[model samples]
Target: MVDVFLEFMLGPMRAIGDYYFEHQMLFNAIVIGGALYKLASGKKRHEREAENCN
Candidate 1:
């Protein structure tokens, strides 16, 4: 039944939502730091490639 499927899906989703709410700051910090690291590394890689081309 749809109810059964919804319960099954929502149960795990609810748990994940609760966990995110409880550790929002930690998650935000991790996401932001990861994004910054990727951007910085990508810029450096492009610069290196440009130097090699020249």
Candidate 2:
């Protein structure tokens, strides 16, 4: 049933939400660090590709 499927999906999501609520600062730091890391790596990759094209 749809209820069963929703419970299965939402159960883990609820746990994650609870954890984030309890550890808001840690979670925010992790998210921001991950975004920065991706941005830095993407910039380096673009620079390398540009150098190769030239």
Candidate 3:
């Protein structure tokens, strides 16, 4: 079941994955940057609530 699926899916996926893996720096940079941006922006909502106490 899984083997059949992988065999079919992985063919095309591997081609794209190969490109992604070859250029992993771009993927990693985007993921890390997006995570950092999400973390920073998430803090603003909490900070806004805190300021509302004033």
Choose 1 or 3, whichever is better by lDDT: 1
* Model 3: per-residue Cα lDDT over 1-54, one tens digit each: 975776687876767766887999999999999999999999998999899999
Best by lDDT: 1
lDDT of 2 at 19: 78
Q: After superposing candidate 3 on the true structure, give the runs of residues whose Cα lies further than 4 Å from its correct spot.
A: 1-9
| Predictions in order: lDDT | 0.90, 0.88, 0.87
Give every collision pair in model 2: none
Where is the poorest 10-residue window by lDDT in model 3? Answer: 9-18
Clashing pairs in 3: none
Tell me the lDDT of model 1 at 1: 100
Clashes of each: 0, 0, 0
* lDDT per residue (tens digit) for residues 1-54 in model 2: 976776778976777766778999998999999999999999999999999999
Q: What is the TM-score of each candidate against the true structure?
A: 0.75, 0.65, 0.72
Q: How much RMSD separates candidate 3 from the native structure?
A: 3.6
Greater TM-score among 2 and 3 belongs to 3
